[model samples]
Target: MATDGHGGLIQPRKVPNPVRESQSHRELHRELLFSHSRGILPRHRAELPRVLESRRLRQLREELQGPPSDLEQQLRKCHQRLEEAAAGPDPGPRPEFLLVRDSLRKMKLAEPGAWQT
Candidate 1:
């Protein structure tokens, strides 16, 4: 039995059985003791924040690159195709017409959500 901070009755702290101590148990106990004295666990003292920051930075970098260049190229090709079609004798819908439409749809889908509204 133990006295609480306000003089109330409280359960006694349990003592670990020294007889059951093994290598792993000793290591665990050491880690627990160290963590209790310090603010953070030793193994993870700097790892968590660094990993999270790196992940955030990677996402930001990818966002900075904007849309992929291939999408822009496809759009340019579509424009060129339109110009050529307008200049030449009207040839009704080529098979490549479907490809241009698909590329435009893909480009729309690949745009960032913020731009989509």
Candidate 2:
């Protein structure tokens, strides 16, 4: 029940977190990502349908996959804090971070939506 200082109620904030998902694209085969860096793969080469049907597994895989990038270094930085050198503590992250976060909110958490489109 927070107020806006004028008797008006304050609405919930919708800003995206500073932990923006990686934003690089790598048209590489899933074999390279393995079950750690990029994300988890089908156990024993299980079919796509099996992986898709399992909602829990799908979510786990996506988390492990990190973010889409052609380079391993970028992937490693995916979920990490944004590196804005001059940003300092005054302004924190840049404005672009918010845009990146908004796009993520519209995406399916466990699905391959980052590089798909």
Estimate the TM-score of every prediction. Answer: 0.22, 0.15
Model 2 lDDT, full chain set: 0.63
- Candidate 1's displacement at residue 53, Å, is 0.3
lDDT of 1 by residue, 1-117 (tens): 565675885668989887557788888888898887886755576887878888999999879988659887899899999999889984766689888999888887898674656
Q: Give stretches of model 1 more than 4 Å off.
A: 1-45, 71-117
lDDT of each: 0.81, 0.63
Total clashing pairs in model 1? 0
- Residue lDDT tens for model 2, 55-75: 878788889998656776676
Q: Cα RMSD (Å) between model 1 and the true structure?
A: 19.3
**Residue pairs in clash, model 1:** none
Q: Following a full C-alpha superposition, what root-mean-square deviation does model 2 have from the true structure? A: 30.3
In angstroms, give how far residue 2 of model 1 lies from its true place: 90
The candidate that wins on TM-score is: 1
